[model samples]
Target: MDTKKPYLAIILIQSIYAGMFLLSKAAFDGGMNSFVFVFYRQAAATIFLVPLALFVEWKSLPPLSFVTFCKVFLLSLFGITLSLDINGVALVYTSATLGAATTNCLPVITFFLALLLGMEALRLKTSAGIAKLTGILTCMAGVLTLAFFKGPHFKLFCLHHSHTADTAAASSSLTWVKGCFLMLTSVTFWALWLVLQGPVLKSYPSKLLFTALQCFLTSFQSFGIAIALVRDPYEWRLGWNVRLVAVAYCGVVVTGVTYYLQSWVIEKKGPVFLAMSTPLNLVFTMLCSAFLLCEFTSLGSVVGGLLLIIGLYSVLWGKTKEQRLLNEKCVSTGVNKQGTELTVVTT
Candidate 1:
């Protein structure tokens, strides 16, 4: 049971995200403003996280320096605020399934960014390197396929609403392409956030506090963006509706609970294991969107999704093999050094 905990935790996290995609899409379909939704979601997350962070980390909290606070602020701005705001608009233009499918590109994008930042190296001579390169190419191919192709649409066994037809009418080819690129941009920022978190965490060293601080700062940032873009005071109002539910679920469950669970899972099973399960999110989102949202799945989407999954695994495999090789080399070098020292001491 203990051994299965991480798997269960990750599955739960994916399930939460699947619900987020569906709920967010539904809310947007009902004409909820994306910017306002971002603000409310972040505010909700802050409300939930602040007290919990205080309770769990208050006694042992280290004094936060201004520099670290600024870092966290910037992180929140680009990572959560921008990524989510853009993603909401993208979801408005595209289907929840596309949003989920595009997320599979994150690992590949992160790897590419790492290479550019000199944080990772590629050895063309090695099979691992070849796999990584192939994966990158495959992921791009998948993205292109998704963006350009919408083959025959097939409906699942679900209620077909007039709203679905209206949405399809509004989604022109240009809008679909724009949404695809927007989704890509959102994932890029998210990947950047993942890469930058390492150094910030080293400086702050408190996971709970760091996450809470980001959410807190993001709420204010998103609020500013929301108010600037959406001046209609009426748009800010949240009644007893799907908008409210989406905000609450995204803020509390997706942001708050998932963060805690993900941290635990990463600690126990490592990030690679967690990343490998991302395809499960696509699967869940696809099914839920079909049944609940009455969304159509195109042949191109299925084919592209398959390609993206293939790319994700290929990259993960290469990364894992590279790490294993590096560890083995270190062990071999240590053994050789120890033997040499013993020989010299005996002499």
Candidate 2:
């Protein structure tokens, strides 16, 4: 039962993310301003998390220096603020399915970024290295397929299409291309955040405080971005509607709750294990978008999504194999050293 906890936690986290995609898409479709939505979402997260973080971690919190604060501020600016703002716009132009499918490239992106940052080595002779390379290529192929192709749209169990003929007609190829690139950019920032977070955490080791500070800072940053772009006061108002629900759910559940849950899962099972479950979020989002949102699924999306999933698993497999080999080598070396010490003592 203890062993299964991490798996269960990850599945729950993915389900929550699936809900986020659906609700966010619904909110966007209902004519909510994406920038304002990001602002409100971060604000809500701040409201929910700040008190909790203070209550839990205040006593044991490390001293936050000015440099660390600056790091957190910049991290929040790029990672949470820009990523969410751009992703919200991308969701408006594309289906929620595509948004989820694009996220499957995160592991590959992170790997590539790690290699670029000199945090990881590339050795083509090894099977693990070859697998990682293949995964990167496969993921890129998936992204290209998703961006260019929209083959054979199929409705799944919907009596009527949610989009009107005129509305569907208004969606041009340029918009699709724009949305694809925006989503990719958002994912890239997110992957960078994930990569850089390791060092930031080491410097300021209070995980709860770190997360809360980011949320707090992002609330303000998103607000500035929102107020600048969204001039109308009406766009900032949240009524008793799906938009409000989306904001609350994304802020409280997706941002606040999932962060804690993810930390627990990562601690228990390691990051690679958690990353391997990301496809479940995509699958759940695709199914929910089809059934609830009545969104049409294209064959290209299906094909591209399959490719992304394959690439994700391939990368995860390589990472896992590499870690296993490293552990074995360390164990062998320790055993040899122990034997040598024993022989010296015997002599």
Candidate 3:
């Protein structure tokens, strides 16, 4: 695929995430618990991806080794199951706008974790990396300021009687706090998944095959929990409404298509280019949240969102510069070698 294609696909992925937020809200409203909703999404994704995987990667299916299976299994649990579980529940407690803003910090966490693990190198001499890190820090400051600082009350719609203005006003405003924390914790798991999956992706180059295995393994992993928790399997009836349709779209397009695109793009362009596109998702998701779900954006949200974008780009800038310098050095060496070869040949 072309370099610009992944950038375009990421837009689609962000839109799917935005749709997921809404469908999840519908699932919550339709008497489905968090675990139930998560179970459904995973089940749907697994079903959708299974056939697609068989069709696309039939010949390329790798021999499922013990080590590779373990990696994929862990990735499925952490990345797909746990990450989405926390995020889906967190969205229930928090507004979509806040969720979008908070999730933008994902890349910053990823960068630091990668650095600590020595998967990513830090060059203090490279101003780009420093600037990028600085930007990430600055964005963190903005998120903190937005989260902790004072802000006026904004009203949307009241869902339940307990969510009425009078009740909401009287209750301690900490659920959102807890929700954000959960989402952040989820981000940590996801970042770890990405770092760990790097090696697995390198070993198994077929994204479709890997994704299919991961999803199938994760479904079985969650199946045990689903059966243990829900007494009646009849409760797992598929709701083929618009909401379920949205969920299906996310499963097929986001998990299946977008994910494969991301893997291919990363393999082609490297992680730096891929990570840089993180902030764009925030923008796209925020816009979709506003229009699709009628989400209200606060001033703090706007400011915090901007800061997150700044920080995300800073990291990208640093990595891009580092790569550029490395390429220049390679070119210089190649030119020197070519000149010496010509000189020796002529003599």
Candidate 4:
């Protein structure tokens, strides 16, 4: 329950997620179909996590109640399948950095959803809450700035094809705008999934098992949809090339390993601290894109990214300070022993 450790862990996770975005973009640039990419990503994530869940939660795993199964299926639908599908599609139309920058607004979306659903109290009068609200708004502004403003572009590969309606949509000048909007929708679905699963997480209390179930369920759902919606293998564009590596990395490392790390961090620190790590993703993405993917940055993008990170840090700092004070006060009052306090902090 060392407060600082959670911050570090979250930063690490964010870096992984950001790198995943760049990798995803590369796969798209190679003409990989979004649906097929998601299908494979989920398939790989499921493969990686299934054995881990079996080993860890084997004895403790409860029999799958119909209700529990349905909830998990729904979580898979919104959080896993839909989010990945939309994000993958959107990335084909947008720059990697812009696609990732939009995700910085997820925390704000989650907070508002919590308030609307009565999961959290609207303590507008409190300085801590006010600071958090301001931070969220500022971060959102940064995301919008990145989306609407074309900072600069150094095109390395100018891809063109026989123009069709789909190609037209994908190659539209406002690709960033559409991508940002789609990413926002993905965030909304992801946030709602988190909110809906609060009770499930409490009841299950096994992150690995939940993650496995989610991936497995979502893979099947996505697979079914892919079969129905995508009739041509030519459209799938599956290639055993660099795009294959990108897909594998996203599936195994990004989805599988990152989820485990994120669950562990949340178990140790709490969701707010975990969420604060999101800005670090931007940093990692920028670095990886520039170095690994040969992406060039523009002045406006740099400023917008800095503003997003600053706003994100402000919110996390405020939350950490408030939590630390509460913990100290509890200790002073002997409300709980160090052991109990640690557990509370971990949660």
Q: List, residue by residue over 1-347, the lDDT tens digit for candidate 4.
A: 57677667777678778878877877776677788878888888889889988998899986677888788888889887898888877777766776677677676677678879897654567777787788778877776776676555443332333222134234555775787788778878887887788888866777778888888898898888777888997866656786778778887888776776787887886777677667677777766666566655555566667767767776666667677878899877785576688998999
Q: lDDT for each of the candidates?
A: 0.91, 0.90, 0.70, 0.74
User: How many clashes (backbone N, Cα, C below 3 Å) per candidate?
Assistant: 0, 0, 4, 0
Per-model TM-score on C-alpha atoms: 0.96, 0.96, 0.84, 0.82
Q: Tens digit of lDDT per residue, candidate 2, span 138-231?
A: 9999998898998888877754567622343358878988999899999999999989999999999998889899999999999999889999
Q: Which candidate's lDDT is highest?
A: 1
Candidate 4: regions farther than 4 A off: 1-12, 152-173, 264-273, 328-347
Off by over 4 Å in 3: 1-10, 153-171, 229-243, 260-277, 287-294
Per-residue CA lDDT of model 1 for 1-347, tens digit only, reads 99988989989999999999999999888889999999999899899988999999999898899998988899989988999999999999999999999989999999999999999999889999999999999999999999999888887887666375357545788998999999999999999998999999998998888888998899899989898999998888889999999999999999878888888998898999999999999999998888888888888889999999999999999999999999999999999999999999999
Report the Cα lDDT for residue 300, model 1: 87
Query: Which 10-residue window of candidate 2 scores lowest in summed lDDT?
Result: 160-169
TM-score of structure candidate 3: 0.84
lDDT digits (tens) for residues 274-311 of candidate 3: 66666665676556555555555456667777887788
Model 1 lDDT at residue 252: 93
For model 4, name the residue pairs that clash: none
